[model samples]
Target: MQCPLPRIAVLWSALLFGLALSAGTTPALAQAERCPKLVAGNPFLQRLAPRTVPAAYVAPRQVGLTYIGHSTFLIETAGGVTVATDYNDYVRPAMVPRVATMNRAHSTHYSLNPDPGIEHVLKGWREDRDPVHYDLDIDDLWVGNLQTNIRDWRGDTIRNGNSIFVFRAADLCIAHLGHLHHTLTHDDIGALGRLDVVLAPVDGSYTLDIDGMIEVLKSLEAPVVIPMHYFNESTLENFLTRFAGRDYAIERRESPELVLSRETLPRKPTVIVLPPGG
Candidate 1:
């Protein structure tokens, strides 16, 4: 359900969720960083290279992720849990997602009138400056948020206006950076724990600059990195150029969906280019 966490509360959603909570970069995230139930995001821990998404949903120990243009992505878990990241009215999943996450950057990043079918709606920002905490554990999936500040069009900063949603599924930990405006801090990286996959924004000016975003990715050290939120091929290519092919093996996917499992993860860090549109 509908779990309205205690206002001004940190990782205290136990009343409804009864699971440990994490809200983007808040002190509460340290809890999830230490939770044993969460996935250990080490792609190299497995053997063969990753596999692709099949027509059928993923099997146990596998997660299917589909990019729905812009910053939205549909995350499917082994237990049939569906999570829509950066969910907005303009860009959304073909089918209604079980959980919808939104940021306060703009209308394109969130929807005021979300579908009632969505069982959980996690908003990144609050009216006050306090960061929002969400620790939703249903079936075999766990979703949490890391709140970060964003710069408005007026060049002013909105503290905790954006969030980086983390999804722990099967044996993979996937992170989606939502409307991120700046580089991360030391504490920010520590709270994120280890990430197996990262869906990052590559539009230099609108989001973080290419170099800064690269630093953030390097810090997370995820084996697989997917590019999103870029305007055109030029910008995406520019960001890809920063990574040396020797260290990061770049691959292009024909489809927008990716089926990932610990046993199929890459041996080294890879920057995957998934076809745009879900």
Candidate 2:
């Protein structure tokens, strides 16, 4: 004996037919067109660059980071790539970084001999040498650096090389603005493309002042900004006060390290505070 068609199936088929007639498109055609493109050579695929990680790339279960007091930060990327900015003594003893950057402005900025485990050590300045632009590409880490300068303690303008390190991983571009004492030129802006997150020095003493820093942020317009170099709460408060009218949200994360992707970023500007021990 032939079985009868289910009542619910018949009703659903009729509803779908009616919707298709109203929309002027077949369900199969619409579904086929809506499917995401995965080819690497397509122009549309560039947008996916921030989301695609190579199969060889190993995602870390926990992204390790330690806020080595002052302007130093140690970031271990998902692929076991270690990056240390302004390598100093304040870093946690547990983190044995593979790569480190040193700026020659102050004692806190540079350490002559770091751990023996560190394979790649990049110095911002070279003796009697012209400015160098370095591009480092390991298995899963991409770092680019540009040299800049800041003033010294003697009230005299000094030419010290600073590295603006950019790390690209897990479909996000993170930049560390090291002791940026001057405004970014148009060329500088062009070189540094869309930034998902930015680590900036807000102390206003060594780096750019409050107003200058604000201008830099406005020009860059990164989605997330993490302020560093401030000594006390009052300094941070002063920096936060400037964004009263702005729609920037301040979020205090339990840890200094944040994992993110293209789909998880905020629409408006956000300030993330990473307190000590975080």
TM-score of 1: 0.83
Clashing pairs in 2: 50-171
**What's the distance in Å from true for residue 169, model 2?**
1.0
| Clashing residue pairs for model 1 | 24-145, 24-146, 24-147
How many collisions between residues are there in candidate 2? 1
lDDT of 2 by residue, 3-73 (tens): 13354355335433543443111221111111111111234433433332322323533234456667787
Tens digit of per-residue lDDT, candidate 1, span 1-278: 11133531443333123222323245544444522233344343222323333336788789999988899989987667788888899998889888999988878899999999999999988979776777766556677877788888999988788878888877678888999998887767766777889999998989999889988989989999999989899988888887655488999999999999978989989999998788
- Quote the positional error of residue 110 for candidate 2 in Å: 1.1
True-structure lDDT of candidate 1? 0.77
User: What TM-score do all the candidates reach, one by one?
Assistant: 0.83, 0.74
Q: Give, for candidate 1, the lowest lDDT window spanning 10 residues.
A: 15-24
Candidates' lDDT values, in order? 0.77, 0.63
Quality of model 2 by C-alpha lDDT: 0.63
